[model samples]
Every structure is written in C-alpha cells, then in structure tokens.
Target: MNRNKSLFYFAAFFAMVIYGISTTIIGAILPQLIDKFRLTGYSAGTVASIMPLGITIGSIIFGPIVDRFGYKLLMFVASITVITGLYGLSSTSSVDILRISVLLIGAGNGIINGTANSLVSDISGEKKKSRLSLLHAFYGIGALGLPFMLSVFSSVVSIREVFLIISISLFLLALLLVFITFPVAKKNMGLPLSEILKLINNPLLLLFAFFLFFQSGMEGVAGTWITTLIQKTRIDNYNSALAALFFLILALTIGRFLISFLLKHFTRFRLLQVGLIIVISGAVIIFSINNYYTTITGLVLMGFGFAGGFPIILSFVGDNYQSISGTAFSLIFVIALSGSMIMNIIAGVISDTFGIQYISILIIACVFIMFFLLYNLNSKMSMK
Candidate 1:
C-alpha cells in the first residue's frame, strides 16, 4: 500500500511535468514554426490562441468525467492524445494540421493537469497545500527544463527530433499509467444537477474562483510580456530578454520548493498576504527601475510572489470540497484560464497602443486587485 501510494504521487508529478512541457513547447519553438511556415503576426496569434481555447474546453469537462469514471482512463486517454499531438507536430507540414495538433496537446494537457491536481488533493488529506506545492514544483522543473534543453540541443538536433523524443517519453508514461492502480471514482455514476448548481452558487467557491482570475491574469501577463518589457526598457538583446524570462520561471520554481517548507511555519493566509506584498514590491521595482540587474531582480521577486497563489488556493478548494473536488477544480481552472486569456489580450492591446513598458503597470494593477480579492476571501474563509 505504501508503494502504491508512492507510485500514485509519482504519476501525478510526472503528469505535471508533461503539462509544463506541452504548454511551454509552442513558445519555445514559435520562432522555428514561424520561420518554417512563414507565419504572419496575425496568423501566429491565431494559432497561439487556439491552444487556450482547447484548454478551456478540456477544463470545462474533465471534472465530471474524472469524478464519475476515475483517474486511470482520463489520464491514459489524455496521455495518448498528447503523444499523438506531439508526433503530429513533429511530422506535419501543413499549417492546418499543425493547429489541430496544438489543440490536441492543449486539451490533453488540460485534462492531465486538472486530474493530477485533483488526485493529489484527494490523497493528501490535510497536507494538500504542501503536497500541491511540491506537485507544482515538478511542473516548474519541466517548464524550466524544456527551454534549457532546446537551447542546448538546438545546434545539434532538429526541432522535429526533439518533439519525437518528448513524444516517446510521454508514450512510456502512458504505458506506466496502464499498470498503476488509480483510486476509484468519487461519484458512482453521475453527479446530480442540484449538486452542480450548489457548487456554482456557493459564494465562497465563487470568491476563490475570482481570486484565481486575477492571479492567473497577473501570471499570464508576466510570463507573456516580461521579455518584451525587458527588451523595451532595459535590454535590446533577444538572448538577454529571454534570460529575464528564464529567471522569472527559475525563481518561481525555487519559490515553490521554498513555500512547501515555509507552509509548516506559517498559515497559508499569512503566506499569501506576504506573497502579495512581495508581488507589489516587485512590480514597483520593474516599473520604476531602468537597470537590467534591477529588472531581473524584480522579475525574480514577482516569480516568488506568484508561486504561492495557485497551490494555496487550490488546496483550500480541495480541503473544502473534497467530495466534488474534480468539478470544483474544473470550475476554477476554466475561470482562471479565462482570466489568463483576457489579460493577455489586454496586455497585447495596451502594449501596441501605448507602449510595452505599460505591461509592468498592468501587472501591478492586477496584483492590487488580487490583494483586494484575497482580503475578502480571507474574511469569508475565516467565517467558514
């Protein structure tokens, strides 16, 4: 039983690694895709947006399926879907096929990501925050690892070859899933309509969902635009700009591990409050400082600031809604992804019309809004 539990935890962590890789791969190889396909800015944006659409669609449906059917089938199928997508991406020449492949990857990742988090929450009991934080830390490993891998291998290997290698790895993971014994379905056959409505109408749930909204937005903007902002304000070199983005993710990854330890010493709410303060300070530094080192420092601080929100909030949701965790997670993820999409659009428009530097301003605004939401959420949670 102990061995089985360990395997379950390993599977969850492995799934998150896939999640991190699939989500970041497009960004890592976008330049190659653009060069190969001769894609225009508009076409590239359209292609990029399709992934999130796929993710949102996948997020909307995974909860009920997982709750009713259990983790094994959903995870296995999602793994296969992602593998097919990666293979398709490596082999396809047609842009139409490429888009479909991207969609598949996104959808598969959404299912895997949601299911893994829900599974951990169910298994961890009272240790959800620390466990989730550690789970997400693996995600950071994949997120940070892939680009570094690409950079190292780019000169020696073709991008298609890299995709094939990743696909092969995922195929092995899929096979491993077939042998692992997953926990049984939480709901027997179906979730009643009343339960669905109750989850939707729960004010505390909604509060947590919306708090994630701004949190996701802030993260989306920072991840998407920080490089551009760095280039516009502090550095002109592309590699240097990329390094700034790298540091942000690196800091985030490190911060998660740190938070996992720190949770033992502090309340999640107090940690969250401290994180917000750190985020505000980081945003100010980015907005006001012109030096490269200072900007990178600010990005690092922002990364650390951003690390605690999802794990902490999702743990709260998991703790409170254990019976229907899959559905609850689905709701929050869909809402959170919507926030990501909306904020990316806003940042793009603002960057185009005003200046790229305003991206920092937008991040600062979102963090403040998150802080407001977090305060209210704390009060509500306390009452509960």
Candidate 2:
C-alpha cells in the first residue's frame, strides 16, 4: 500500500476501534447504570434496546446521506454527534436523557460504521472484501480490548467518568478525520429507499440477507450467553466464564485480521464455506460438551468463523452494485439488526422459561440456519 492509502486504512481502523468501544462499553457499564438509577426490569430492557432501535433508524437516514454527500461530511457529522452524545450521557442523571444520549451515540456509530465501510469498499478496487474485513477486525479488537481497559477503572471510578473519557477520545478522532482528506464519493441520484427496497427482488441479496441475519443473531447470542453457558458447566468460576466471553470476542477480532491476509489466496465463496463448516462444528461441540476448556474452544471457533461475515457481505453488495451501495447497506443492516434485536430478546425469553442451557441450544439452532442459508447460497452460485 502507498502512504496515502496506508494512512486512510489506519484512520479507518482507528475510527472503527473508537466506535466499537462506544457500543460495547455499554454492555459492561449497564449494570452499574441500572443500580445507579434503580431501574425496573422492563425499564432497563427498554433503555438497553434503544441503541439497536436507533441503529435501525439511523441506517435508514445515513444511507442517503452517505450516497449523496460523501464520506468526510458524514464522518464528521457522525463523530461529532457520538462525541456529544457520550458527553451528554456522562453528564446526565435522568434516565430519559440517558436514553436519548444512547440513541444519539448508537445512531452516530451506526452511520459512521456504514460510511467508513462503504468508503473502504469504494477505494479497494479488487480487494474490497479483504480490506473491509481488516477494518471490521479492528472494530472487534476495540470491542475486545476496550472493556478490559474500562474494567481497570470500573472498581475505582463511576461509569460516567468512563463515558467522559470515551467522549474525549471520540472528539480527538473526529477532529483528526476533519483534517484528513478523503476521496470524493460517487454521485448517486437514485432514490435510496426505493433502491434498498429493490434488493428484495435479487435472490442472491435476499439469501445473503438471511445468512447475515442469522449470523448477527448468533453473534449477539454468543456475546450475551457465553458466560452463562460456561458457568453452567459447573467447573469454571464466573471470572473464567467472563474470560471465555472476552476470548471469544478477541478471537473474532483477530480472526478477521488473519482473513485479510488469506483473502489474496482464496475466493469469497470458498472462505465463507469453510467458515460455515467451522461454525457448525463449533456449535455442535458447544452444545454437546459440559467441559470448560472445550466450551471455550468451541466459542473461539465460532467467533473466528463469524468475524468476517458482516464486512464481507457489505463489501459484496458494494462491489456488485455501485449505484445502490448505500441502499444495499441500509437494507442488509436492517435485516442484520432486526435479527440481532429479536434473537437477543428470544435468548432472554428462552433463558427465563427454559433455563440458560436453552440459550446454547438456541445458538446451535441459529448456526443451523446459517448453514441452510449458506447451503442455498452456494447452490445458487454453483448453478450460475
């Protein structure tokens, strides 16, 4: 890579890392917020759900913005919004304010994510998916690393202070992007909503959407339930279970980084097929085993398999249809976000009714759905 491209990649990766921390830190700090606010169960669930809800809505708005206005403007706006929202969250005591703050932060992050990935795809002529995977891997790295960094302060400081620090970091990054030059986005005159809606008629895109929907759900399930799944083994302590969850996420982050290197030598379909097989085997192991080591191993395998999915699929959309990249991203993200939201809710319901053990079963079932989608995708491609 040339110096300019290298710089852009680094900035994109750093930005993604910063954004990842913004989203995942909430998972760790939410319990503190709940205790601090004395929130009811339903109230807390509603509060927690606001971000994904905002992301779904944000994608709708951002797609047109990115398609029409270009990356730099959208990135600047998104970064400022998220930084401000985080600052707002840090200063707020009211639950209503916190909800609104989270909504802004979530929406900002979602827009930034979409814009950055779309930009990466635009620049990467031949190696689109590979580079996009690396960018996303950095996101995974931040998601894995930032929590541990935040945990160091959890015992010593308030969650508000943590958000304040994150807000500062976001501001700095936003300023940096403000000064950096980016390539002009292609002029798109299409109706973003109509273009996105039109993707439904494309069989491959529809099949890919289902694959991603299940993939996103499986990821959310693993993030939420892995600790519980490990603890149910009765051999590991809670600390170990938590460690397993981090390991799983770290594996995913690192896996995407490794995939960037491998993409030069492999086809997208080939890599995806191998990944699905690994995920299926991992799910099976997780469901059948009660041992901690085996469970952690299985989680890691599944994480690695799932790591490149979203970026690869998004890049695929961008590569195939230049005129409708924004619309494609919006539609695909809606499907993925919906699956993530619904599956998370389902995991909670299943855990409450059938016990936490059923979450692992649910995850395994989602993996099967992934298999079915991938199978159909592969078949269709083969026939083509």
Candidate 3:
C-alpha cells in the first residue's frame, strides 16, 4: 500500500475505535446510570438498545445516501452527528433526553459502521477482507479502551466527564476527515436505486447478513450485560465485577490484534468457526465455574471469541460485493443492529424474569446458532 492508503487505513481504524467507544462507554457506565435513574433491568437494557435501534433506522437510509453522495461526505456528517450526540448525552440528565441522545449516537454510529470498512474495502483492492478485519480490530481497541480508561478515572471522575472527552475526540476526528479523500463506489458511480436494490438481494450477501444478525445479537448480549451479570455473581463485589468487565474488554481488544496476525494464515470462515467454538466453551465454563477468578477467565474467553466475528463478517461482505460495498454493508448492519436491539431487549426480559445468571445459557445458544450458520455458509461458499 502507498503512504496515503496507509494513512487512510489508520484514519478509518480510529473511526472504528471511536465508534466502538461511543457505543460501549454506556455499557461500562450503565450500572451507574441505572442506579441514578432507579431503573429496572429491562429499562436499562432498553436504553442501551436504543442507540442500535436508531442505527437500524439509519442503516436503512444511509445506503441510498452513500450511493447518491460519497463516503467522505457521509463520514464527515456522521462524525459530526456523533460529536453532537455525545455532547448531548453529557448535557442531559432527563431520561427522555438521554434516550434521544443515544439515538443520535446510533445514527452517527450507523454512518461510520456503514461507510468505514466499505471505504477500506474499496481502496484496498485485493486486500479487502484483511483490511476490513484490521479496521475492526481498532474497534476492539476502542471498545476495550473505554472500560479500562473509565476504570482508571472512574473512581475520581464522573461518567458525564467521560462523555465529554469522547465527544471532543470525535469532533477532532471529524475535523481531520475534512482533509482526507475517500473512494467512490463502483456501481454507485451511476446505478439507479432499483438496480442497487436488485444487487442488494444477492443470496450470498443476504445469507451473510442473516448470520451477522445473530452474531451481532450474541455480541451485544455479552457487551451490554457482562458487567451486570458479573455483579450478580460470586465476585468480590459490584465494584469488582465492574472492574473485571473492563478487563474482559481489554482481553477482547488484545485478542483482536493477535487475530489480525493469525488471519494471514487462516481463512475468515475458519477463523469465524473457531470464534464460535470459543464462545461456546466460554459459556459452558461460565456454567461450571464457581469462583470469581474462574468466572473472569470464562468472560475473557467469551470476549476473545467474539472479537473476531464482526470484523471477519464485515470484511467478507466487502470482499464479495465490491461494487455495492456500501449498500451491502448497510443492509447487513441494518439487520445486525436490529438483532442487537431485539436480543438486548430479550436479554433484559430474560434477566428480569429468571435473573442474569441465565444469560450465559442464552449466549451459549446464540453462539451455537452462529456455529450452525457459519458451517452452512462455508459449505455453500465451497460448493460455489
């Protein structure tokens, strides 16, 4: 890759990290938010799910906009939205205002989620999947970083201040995007919406989207509820569980970087299969482990297992549908975000009724579904 391409990749990677942080910082601080608001488990999960719900709406619209406009422009707009949204989140104490802010954050996230990997996929030519995977590794970095950063300063500072810092970081990145150039989509160079919709129906792409829907749900289950689940466990205390969850995110971040190297030697499909297996193992371990230390180990394995799936699936979409990369990714994200929202709601309900301990079993089931879907996807792709 040329120097510009390398720079673009890093910029795109940072965007992913920022987006990840925006999405997850809430998860890290959700327990506190719930306490402040006096919210039930279901309500807290609903608030957490709200952003992805907005992202689902944005995902549906962004494809057409990106096709009509361009990635650079859409990305700038998205970053602006994120900055405004995060600032809004920091400014609000009302539950309704908080929900609206999260929605805007989701909209901003939808734009970045849809566009960044598509841009990398477009620019990297043959290295589409690998580039996309590396970009997502940065997301892991950001998601992991949020909890660790918060854990460091959480004792001394407030979550509102954290939102302010994240917002400022996003605004600066938005300013930087003004100087960067991005690639145009091939089909979107001139294609009509009708033609784009036809292309969006590609069976392979749809199947991948279907797989990702469940994958996103599984990932959300862990990301949103891990801290809460830990708090309910035999951990040292609520504070200790919160700290351990951050460590789990850190493990996930580290695992993604390590897997980036491993991807050079393995196919995305093989890597996904391995991830599903690891998740299942983690879930089972969660069931068996009685001690807090063993529980953290299980959670770390779960995090490591999940770290690879999104990046790999996204890279697969970009690699397969080069011309309609943005559209394809948007569709996949639409379903995935919807899945994230719906399953979180479900997890909330299940936890409310049966308690959070059962979340491990529920997550195990989702991973098994992912395993089946990936196995089928691999089989079909091979036959083709």
Candidate 4:
C-alpha cells in the first residue's frame, strides 16, 4: 500500500479500537460508578441507556460533516471530546456528570465508527468487506483488552487513575492522527437537507437501514444481557458468568480474524447467510440449557455467526454510494442504534417483568428477525 493508504488503514484500525473501548468500558466501569454515585437500578439503567442516544446523535450528525469537510478536523475534535469525557468520568461523583461523560464518550465512538468504516471502505475499494472484517477484529481486541488491563493493574492503580492515563494516551494518538493524511472527500459529496431527505427515501437504502436496525438490536441484546442471563440461570456463579462473557468476546475476536480468509473463499452474501444460521443455532442452544460448556459453546457460535453482518452490509452501502458513503453510513448507523435502543428498553421490560430467563426467548426472536432481514438485504443487493 502507498503511504496515504497505509496511514488511513492505521487510522481505521485505531478508530475501531476506540469504538470497542467506548462500547465495553461502561460495563467495565459500571460498578465503580454505582459505588461513587450511589445509583439505584432505575438511575443506572437510565445512565446506561442515555449513551446510545448520544451515539445516535453523533451517527446522524457526523456523515454530512465528514462529507463536507473531510475526516481530519472532525477526528481531532472527536478525540478531544473523548478525552474530556474520560476525564469527566474519572473526576465526577455526580450522577448527572457521569451520564454526560458517558454520553460524550458514546458520541465520540459513534463518530469514530462511522468515519472509520467509511474511511476504510473508501481506501480498500474492492476489498471493503474483507478489510472491514479485519478492522473490526481490533474492536474485539480493545473491548476484551480493557477489562484485562484493569485486572492486571487494579492491585496498584484505581480505575479512575487508569481512565486518566488512557485519556493522555488518546491525546497523543490524536496528535499522530493530525500528521497523517486521509482520503479526500468527493468535491460534490455534500448534500442539502432536501437531497438527504430524498436519499433516505430510497427504497434500497431504507431496506439496508432497517436491516441494520435489527442487526444492531440483536447484537445489543446479546452483549448487554448475556452475563445477566448466565447469572440468573446459574445462580451464585458470577465468576463462571464472567468467564462465559470473556469467551464470547474471544470467540468474536477469533471469528473476525478468520473473516479475512473467509472472504477470500466466500461471497459476502453467502457468509452473511451462514452467519445468520449459526446465530440461530447458537440461540437455540442457549435457550435450552444452563451449563457453562453449553453456554460458552453457544456464545462462541453466536460470536462467529454475528461476525459477518456489519462488514458485508456496509460493503454494499459503501460500494453503491461511493460519493456519499459517509452520509449513507450515518443513516444506517443512526437507524441501527435507534433499533438497539428500542430493543434494549423492551428487553429490560421483558427481563424485569417475566424474569431474566425470558431474555433467551427475546434473543432467539431477534436472531430469526435478523435472518429475514439478511435475506431481504441480500436479495436487494444482488438485484443491484
């Protein structure tokens, strides 16, 4: 690769790492925040839910800005936002401040996810899905690594101190990003509200958007509730539940690493269909039992199954709308996050009222829904 392309790929990988940390760090830090803020269940849930809203806002807003202005300035600002949010999180004892910090971090993550995916797709050209799959592997690494790092250092440094140190490292990374050159935006890429509205009204785009909706919702449900499901079902086995969760992420990381090779042998649509089937099978397995071996096996299956969804779907979007990919991605991401937020609330209700055991039923239903959405999405893309 040329220097620019190599640098862009590095940035893309870095962006995914940032996104992974932002996504998982909340669960890692939640107990600490609760202890510091004296949070009730409702308040804690509210705090958790509010971050997605910030993500949605960022997803909606970043595309046009990137399309108009390119990625450099936006990334610089986003990194700063994340650093500020982390510092705020470390410093704050107020419930409201903690929520705001989480929100800001989510927004930064949202921007990074959209920009990096679009940026990588733009740079990779024909290899969009393959490289995106590889890029997303770093997300798994970051997600899983944070907790591991905290575990390693928790004996010496507090979580708050760790957050502060991370903030400083990100500031340095942002400076490096400032010196790297990225792909230039198309001269005519910027869209007015009228054009953006028309773009959203496209039947194909809407189909993709809705597919991502269910996709993100399914993922959100699994990641958010899997530990709880394990704990509720197993009873007094928090360590095993935590281990199961780690296995899930490890499985996902391995699956992502494999995707680079898988894409060489399989078409994106075929892989997506296979992923859905695997997810369905895993869901079925998990729905039926409470054993660690069984649960971990199902999580691993689900991990490998769900791995192909984002890269494949996004490859189509980036392929079809090269000039406006950033904006196109924004639309789908916003819709996806919205769907995830809605499903999280519904899952909360179901788990709370009918017991957490019912969450398996919810997850299974989501998998089936994703299956159909994948079918429709594949059919639509094939037609193109």
- Name the candidate that leads on TM-score: 3
Candidate lDDT values, in order: 0.82, 0.73, 0.79, 0.77
Tens-place lDDT per residue, model 2, 174-197, is 788877777655555646555555
- Give per-residue CA lDDT, model 3, range 1-384, as digits (tens): 387787788778888889888888667777777887888989988998997897887787677677667767778888888877887787777999888888999998888877776777778876766666677778877887777767777678676777777878887788878887655545545557686678677777777887888888877888888777777667535567667777677777777777778889987887888888888888888777766778888888888888788778877777677666667778888888788898888989988998878878888888777777887888888987
Ranking by lDDT: 1, 3, 4, 2
C-alpha lDDT (0 to 100) for residue 238 of candidate 4:
43
Model 1 scores a TM of 0.92
Model 2: which residue pairs collide?
A: none
TM-score preference between candidates 3 and 4, better one: 3
Displacement of residue 67 (Cα, Å) in model 4 is 0.8
lDDT of 1 by residue, 91-202 (tens): 8999999999988998888898899999999998778889999999888887776666665655787767777777887888899999999888989977898998999899
lDDT-best of 3 and 4: 3
Name the best candidate (by lDDT). Answer: 1
Q: Where in model 4 is the C-alpha error above 4 Å?
A: 31-43, 151-153, 235-240
**What's the lDDT for residue 172 in model 2?**
79
Per-model TM-score on C-alpha atoms = 0.92, 0.87, 0.94, 0.92
Q: Which ten residues in a row have the lowest lDDT in candidate 1?
A: 40-49
In model 3, which residue pairs have backbone atoms overlapping below 3 Å?
none
Order the candidates by TM-score, highest first — what do you get? 3, 1, 4, 2
**lDDT of candidate 4 at residue 169, scale 0 to 100:** 62
Candidate 1 collision pairs: none
